[model samples]
Every structure is written in structure tokens, then in C-alpha cells.
Target: MKKKFLIVVLTLVLSLTGASSAFAYDGWADSKQTAYQFQFPVLGVSIVLNSATDVDWYSYTNNTGSPHGLSAKLQSPPGLIYDFAMIVGGSTSYFSSDTPGGWVKVTIAGNIAPGETVYFQVRGHTYSQFSTTAPYNFTITT
Candidate 1:
């Protein structure tokens, strides 16, 4: 009876530990980041990358049959290396920030198909500094 009780207690402890470990705060990369639901004319969206390893993700749905016009403007803090990118069908286009507190805009070709997924990611060009204030606005004109 004593041995059975001890084994049961050990099993419970190990199970609890394993369960807790499953939900640990795991950081995300571009490959593993969660996709945020996006629709066009998103405006004045704010984000902060506390470190160079941070990546922000937004996914867009294009339902327009003839292709849609996509644009984004990032308001980046001055003195930081920042860029936003558009990724679709393994193709990429980027807009880089040239000045702090300046707007960086990118125009994507409207060749995207309906029901296709477009991913927008924001990150630092160099991972040495942090961005304290970053806000971006986006639009899709069908």
C-alpha cells in the first residue's frame, strides 16, 4: 500500500510539472509567429518590438477578384533601424525607415488572388536597439 501510494504521488507530481511546461511563455519568430486577422483599411495600428528578436504579424484576406491595391505606412521612432514587409506566394517587398518619426510607405502590386493570404511583418533591420514607439497604418483599395 505504501509503495503504491508513493508511486501515485510521484506520477501526479510529474504530470503536473509536464502540464505546466506545455503552456510556458514561448517567444515567437517569423516562422512561428501567430497570424493576426487583418482587413483593409487598417489605420493607426500601434506595435512595439522590445527587442530585435521580436516580429509582428498581420494577415490579410483579399476577396476582390481583379486584384487590390495595398499600401502601408509605418511611423517609426527616429534613430532606429526598422522595416515592414509584404509577403505573399513566397514573394516579398520591403519598406525601410530612413528617419526617426518618419513615415515609411510600401505599395504592393494588386496581383494577389482572392482567398490568398498576405502576411505583413515588422522588424528591426538590425537587432541591436529596441523600438519604443511604432505605429503603422494600412489600406487595401479594391
Candidate 2:
């Protein structure tokens, strides 16, 4: 009886150790890196700027079949002097009325169809009157 009870206790301890080892092997996915490419045939999309500092102004122009626009909302931390303009094909077109604060939205007007690509030129100064680099997340959905 004593030998049988010892064997049973040893088996239970080994099972519990195996279970703890499985839990220790789990890992979380990396959020900062993208796992997949954007899907094609996207109707519209939004670009979120997650910057360590204020974002300098940026520009984006669409030449697809439908007109495209860009909007932004300033988060807490240092703000930016937002100025944006777009030139579709050739003509210069201004989209922003006033300097955007908090959140700003700018729309690009042009014919954007499938396969065509857009071009953008963004320039702005941060609250520190210096250039800042920010990670912009663009999500295009059909």
C-alpha cells in the first residue's frame, strides 16, 4: 500500500509540472509590426498618426476613380501646425481651411479607380518648431 501511494503522488506531481511548462510557453503577438498586407479593392481608408512627438504636416493625393481625402485628430502631448494641400494630376488644390487642432480632416478630390496609385507631399513644423517623425497607420477597407 505504501509503494502504491508513493507512485500515485509522483504521477500527480509530474502532471502538474507538465501543465505549468505548457503555460510558460505561451507568447503574445507583436502589435507594432504588421502581420499581413492590406487587402486590394479597398473603397476607402484612414491613416492614424501615432507619433512620439508632434507630427509635421503631411499631404496625400489620389488618382483613382473616386476622390480621396485625409483627416487627422491631434492627441495629447505636443500639438502641430497642420497645413496640407494636394495637386491632382497637375492643378494645385488646397483642402484645409484653417490650421487644424485636436483632430483635423483633409479630403483629396480626384478620380480614383482600382490599380491607380496616389501621391502625397506633407510638410509641417511641430510645437517645438522642429521636424518630428511619426508612425502613420493606414487602414484601407473595401
Candidate 3:
């Protein structure tokens, strides 16, 4: 009986440890359905493109009862290329840059109506560059 109890406890502990490690990356999931939601006008939210296929998603809603302009600006690390995009209503605006260490901006205002939500995606450009030690930061401007 003691041996069986010990095995159960070890299994529980191992599962818990694995679960904790799964959420270590910026506390955000990798899909649009599980994307992290944040308030608009956010400044400098740090994120990482940890792998070649890692894509991060975020959403923001316009609830001001009026149309407001929205912009996504990404600042990539040196020697790495990144892409940024925004989906407002049915319209999509994408921005990509080959120049490392610069800010790429995407703006869409007229497409977002009052009470409408928009989604943003950030990822490595065409599997060109990814960094686990370096993080690319972004800002949502209104």
C-alpha cells in the first residue's frame, strides 16, 4: 500500500511540474482562439518569437461608442526580422520588414467601428529569424 501511494504522489507532482512549464512563455497562448486580450493604447508589451513557427495573437475592442484609430507597432531585436498585422472587422493590414532592429507599424482606423474588436498577430518573418533569448516588444496605439 505504501509503495502504491508513493507512486501516485510522484505522478501528481510530475504532472504539476509539466503544467507549470507549459505556460512559461509570456503567459499567452499561441492561437487566435486562446489569444491574450488587452486594453487599447497599451505601451510596450514585451513578447517573444521563440520558434520559427511561433505566432502570438492579441485582441482589443473599441468600446468608446465612437470610431477610433488603431495602430500596432513592433520593435524587433537586432539581427532578427519580424512581421506585424492587424485584422479590423474584415479588413487586414500586414507589415513586414527585412531591416533588423526597427519598428514596423500597421494602422487601421476607418475599418474599426464602435463596439468592434480587432485582432493582431506577431511572428517571425517567413521563418527567417527567431530568438529565445531576445524579445520583440509591441505597442497598441489609439
Candidate 4:
């Protein structure tokens, strides 16, 4: 009976995992879906950048009563590499790492008023410091 119960739990876990992956938002920006949209606890979402100036915009609202902090992890796709960084309000902030295609974690502390629109940008650090461009997946949190 114990072994049977364990098997059932394992199967359930695997099914739920697969379901989450199936529902994960995939693809780039479009007219309706202007940017990669997500709330807290976003799963693996695709972010593609072609060059230094290229970027992916993510939008979220500040609904928490007070200020809330935000962070996102950028992971390289398959075999390629990129230097990931984040900027708020169209200005540059800090980067996750210096290595191309390496994992970059961006952090921000916000005291935004409730119902304010927050824009966070995900960009690649290209061959140039001012312009390192590439692509990867990102998970954001607040």
C-alpha cells in the first residue's frame, strides 16, 4: 500500500509539472501582447534579442499596499551565451554577470504607489560594454 501511494504521488507531481510547462507563455511581443506579460512567479518565458539595442519589455503593476521589491533571473538558451541586465524606467541599472550567455539576476526595490505601471527591461550585454546583445529566458518576481 505504501509503495502504491508513493507511485501515485510521483505521477501526480509529474503531471502538474508538465501542465505548468504547457501553459507557460511563449513567443515575442505583438500588437495585442505588446510585451512579454507576466505576474509574480512567472515560469520560463522566452526572451529573444538580436543586438545590443534589441530588448524585451515586461510589464507588471504594483498592487501591494506599500513598496515591493522585484527581481528576475536571466538564463542562457541551450548552447549560446549572453550577458543579461535589467533597467527600470528606460534607464540602465545593474547587470547579473559579465559573462556572455551566463545567468544574470537583476534586483530592484520599489516604493511605487498602488496601481502604478512598472516596466522592467531585459537586455543582452553584447561585445561592447554599452552594447552586449543576445537572448535568453527570464523569470520575474515581486
Candidate 5:
């Protein structure tokens, strides 16, 4: 009886640990759905910056219905700048419409100077019918 009890306890502990680890990454689960849309005559866009640790270096989207591409541009106020763009998620085929949208392993260049903020904007178009929440927002940590 004691051996059986120990095994049950171990299983419960392992299950809880796994569930917590699953959400440890910094990213959005539904970025495409939450994206703001422009009316017939206007352009609307939104940007989110997610601070991440070395384990998960960049932010990503978790939607399975459609994939979207993210473009990152690092701007340091007072005239310093750099830009990097990639299709972070979804099918790589340019003609496929069922790609997932989010960031991949791409890294940003330059550090956000003390008291300064770096901006990362992810944008894309999706035809899937779903609703999204705002992309996960992030702040720099010294």
C-alpha cells in the first residue's frame, strides 16, 4: 500500500510541473485574432514588445487556425536603429493560407540603453475567422 501511494503522489507532482512549464514561454496564444482592423478608408496597426529570458528568447503566437508573419524593427531614440524581419510561424510556402503566426528564433540586435525602450511590431494578414486578444506586451529588464 505504501508503494502504491508513493507512486500516485509522484504522478500528481509530475503532472502539475508539466502543466506549469507549458505556459512559461513569453508569447501570445491568439495574436492574429486580437489584431485591430482598419475600416474601409484607414490603416490600423498594433505593436507588442515581450521581454523574455534566455530560455525563450523571443515572443510567438499560438493560434492554429491561421499563421501570420512578424517583422521586428529595433529603434533607439535619438538616431540609432536596426531592423530584422522574418516569417516566425505558419507554413513557409508563400501560397499557403493556413500558416501559424508568431515569432521564431530570430534575435534583435543592440541593447535597449538604460531608461530607453525598444519597439517590436508584429503584423500580418489572416483570413481565418477567429477573435484574438492583444499580443503579449513586454518590457526590458536590466
Candidate 6:
């Protein structure tokens, strides 16, 4: 009886750990130093806000030979809104969704040169609903 109980407890713990990790797909780190490295032309990466104050951070490097335009867009679930921020070559720009759950795109007005790096930050809006299960799709283009 003791061995059976221990086995059942261990099984339940393992199952819960796996289930929790399954929802963490594409989650970014909270700080710029430990931000996720983003590749060019990222399409439809699913991410969750997790909480009201949760912030996701990403960094991308320009690998092209010449200067190129860069843009980032996001689509939140219905009834949710999101805020986006970008830092390119020491300049910062901010963007937010005009309509709830609609796609919002932020384009860098200036072109980024080769070997430059851009950092991004994403968070739920002040009045937005946060969810761990419901994710928003994000895209990055250059």
C-alpha cells in the first residue's frame, strides 16, 4: 500500500509538470539582457501575457548587407489589447493596438543598417485581459 501511494504521487507530480510546461511555447524573457533571440521574418509565434505585469522581451540583429526597413506586428485574442515597444540603435518607439484584438503593426521609420541590433518589449494593455491559455500571435519582418 505504501509503495503504491508513492508511485501514484510521483506520477501525478510528473504529469502536472509536463502539463504546465506545455503552455510555455514561445514565451520570451522579461529583461533585455536575457531576451529571446528573434530571427528575421518570424510568423505567427504564439505567446501569452501570463499576468497583468508580465512583459516579454526579444532581440534581433540585422544581417543584411545594406540598410533595411523593420516592422513588428501582433494580434491579440478577442477582448484583449497589447502594447509594443522597440529599441533600435539607441532610439525607442512605442505602439499599441487601436482596436481590441485587432492586428497592430509598428514599423521603424528609419532603416536599420547591417550589424545593428533591435530590441522589443511586449505587454498587456492597462485594460487588457491576461490569460495563460489564450495566446497572441506575433510577427517580425525586415
Over 68-132, each residue of candidate 2 has an lDDT whose tens digit, in order, gives 44333222113444333443455654432233233334443335444443333223334342222
TM-score: model 3 vs. ground truth? 0.74
lDDT of each: 0.60, 0.33, 0.73, 0.55, 0.29, 0.74
lDDT of 1 by residue, 17-120 (tens): 32111111215324425755554343224556666677766677776666666666666655665677878888887877667556677666667787787787
Between 4 and 5, whose lDDT is larger?
4
In terms of TM-score, how similar is model 6 to the real structure?
Answer: 0.74
Model 5 C-alpha lDDT per residue in residues 88-120, reported as the tens digit of each score? 233221211222432223333432223232223
Off by over 4 Å in 4: 1-27, 30-33, 40-44, 47-54, 83-87, 94-96, 127-135
TM-scores of all candidate predictions against the true structure: 0.64, 0.34, 0.74, 0.56, 0.22, 0.74
lDDT assessment of candidate 3: 0.73
Rank all candidate structures by their lDDT, best first, as comma-separated numbers.
6, 3, 1, 4, 2, 5
Which regions in candidate 5 have their CA more than 4 angstroms from the true location? 21-142
What lDDT, from 0 to 1, does candidate 5 have?
0.29
Clashes of each: 1, 17, 0, 7, 8, 0
Better of 1 and 5 by TM-score: 1
What is the Cα-based TM-score of model 4? 0.56
Best by lDDT: 6
Better of 3 and 6 by lDDT: 6
Error of 2 at 68 (Å): 8.0
Candidate 3 error regions (>4 Å): 1-27, 40-43
lDDT tens digits, residues 36-91, model 3?
77663343367567777788887888788987787778889788888877777687
* Residue 56 of model 1, lDDT score: 67
